[model samples]
Each structure stands twice: as C-alpha cells, then as structure tokens.
Target: MTLDFSWAGEKGCVSLFPNPEFHLENVPAGAKSVSLTLTQGVREMGGEELPLPRNGILPAGTFRTFAPCNPGVYQWTAQAKSATGEVLSEARKARYYPSDEVAEHKP
Candidate 1:
C-alpha cells in the first residue's frame, strides 16, 4: 500500500487545522477492508474503516481526512486486512504546527 499527504513541509511539518487529506493507492489484492488512524502518544485523534468493493480492490486515489486537534508530533497508520486474517500496514510520523505558528515562520 502507498499513502500520500495533501501537504507537507520540512521535516514533516503539517498544518494543525483543516486537517490534511490522506490518499491511498497500490493496495494489495485480496484486501477485503482498509482502515486509517492518527494518534499522538496514546490518544487517537481520528480513524475510520472501509470495506473494499465487490472485487476486493481498493480504488486508486481513495482518501480520507483525519482531524488532529493539537499541535504536536503524530503517527498516522493505514492498514489492510484480508479474509484470511493476513494484514498489511504502514506508518509515518509528522509534526503538526498550529496555523499561527506556520504563518509566523513564513519567509
């Protein structure tokens, strides 16, 4: 599976508000479902799951929006599961900055 963010900055800096959109692609075949989650430490900011289409394929450009309530480092994960109980997952870290903070650093 592959994940892409709508926006990113140096060292994975991201805007805190207007949460970024996650685009997923290249999901492996036989994946019956997929889910996404965002977390900071032990707190889960947002998550959702979707069942794949009848062909058990995730369409290209499938996307979701996750809200990150605070300015801090966060871990985002995407997972795919098959009927046979096999799982595939990916995780990435990002640093979120409040809009004001981002504006202040502008050149």
Candidate 2:
C-alpha cells in the first residue's frame, strides 16, 4: 500500500504542527485496520487506528487519517495491521500540508 502525508513543508524537510489529511491506496486483503501515527524523533505526537468500512473499500481520494494535534517536527507512519496487531505492510512519508488549528482546551 501507498501512504500520503499532508503537511506543509519542503520535500524531505521537518514540519511543525499536525495535518490529519492522508490518503491510502492498494490496501491488502486480510488487513483489519489502518494505523496512523506521528512522531518527533522518539516522542509520540498522536495517532489513530481506524477500521475499514463494511464493504472493505476505503473512502475515495483523501481523508483525515488521524489527529496528531501537536506542534513539532514529526514524521508519519501508516500501517496495515491484523486484529492480533501483526503489521502486514506499512508506508512512511515526511513533511506534507499545513494547519492553524490546535486542540481545544478541556478545562
């Protein structure tokens, strides 16, 4: 499968903030869900693992994959994992898209 990261930065450069916009293609059979994560070096930013639709076909084109809503230099990973958490296949992309929104306060 192919993964596309949506963040605003020059190609192969570090990007600040989070952009949930992502795209996936050619997901393999027997895959249970797609997990997306953002990281700055060894630190976790945020992530999500979403189950595929009942038809087994994902949404067309681009969609928000996960909400890594923190500001930092982060790289992204998209993986197709089994129900038992075995990674089937994965893709990684660095630095794509931009956003101005931050996570809301919960006080």
Candidate 3:
C-alpha cells in the first residue's frame, strides 16, 4: 500500500523513527482493513508554511502526497492497520529529501 509519506516542514536536517524491526507487516493475523499515517515537524524552510499532509495512509505500493508547500528536510512515518480496524502495525519514521530549492541549504 502507498503510505502518505511527508516531512514535518522546511529545514536543513530531519530525523525518523521507524521500528526497524519489520517491513510490510501484511494484514495482521485477523485484520480485514489497513491504514497508515505520519507525524512530522520542521524548523526551517521559511514562509511559516509546511509540506506534506496532516496524516493518512494508502493502498500497498504507490506514491502519495501528504502536504503541499515547499521541499527540504522532512521526517515521516509509515503505519498500517487491519480489516477489523485494529492497529496491526506500529508507525515508523525516516528522513526525506524531496528536493534542493530552498533559499540556502547547509546539508
């Protein structure tokens, strides 16, 4: 499923925290549905604006956009659920570099 991956905001650096324990914890033992979400924040990128959506998830394999604004250092997470609407999996974090177009970057 495609995860709503996104950064917290605009910045020079970002950090992630995805339980490096497993990947694609497919439908839990008895789940009938699944979902994903992300929690992020940033320090720089100006405009007091941020990038990526507030939070959400997607199918199994695809590219989705969270928020829309600028590009820079971003922190995000990928989560999944089951059909029963149970948190089948935990959330994970990671640093993302969408592009290099800020006024000035230092990393």
Output the number of the TM-score-best candidate: 2
Which sequence of candidate numbers ranks them by TM-score, best first? 2, 1, 3
In angstroms, the error of model 1 at 40 is 1.1
- Indicate the residue-level lDDT of 72 in model 3: 37
**What local lDDT does model 2 show for residue 19?**
44
Over 1-107, each residue of candidate 2 has an lDDT whose tens digit, in order, gives: 77664444422222443344567777777888888776656666666688844453444323332334444445667789888888999877654224522222111
Cα RMSD for predicted model 1: 8.5
- Tens digit per residue, CA lDDT, model 1, 26-106: 777777776766666676766667675554344433543344544665655667778765686553534444332222111
Candidate 3 lDDT tens digits, 1-107: 23233323333222322211113433335444433332235432221111222233232223333432344344334334444445555444344454522222122
Q: What lDDT is reached at residue 65 by model 2?
A: 27
Question: For model 1, what is the C-alpha lDDT against the true structure?
Answer: 0.53
Give candidate 1's TM-score: 0.54
| Candidate 1 stretches greater than 4 Å from native | 7-19, 53-66, 93-95, 98-107
Candidate lDDT scores, in order, read 0.53, 0.57, 0.33
Model 2 is weakest, by summed lDDT over 10 consecutive residues, at: 98-107
Error of 2 at 24 (Å): 0.9
Q: Poorest 10 consecutive residues of model 3 by lDDT?
A: 45-54
TM-score result, candidate 3: 0.36
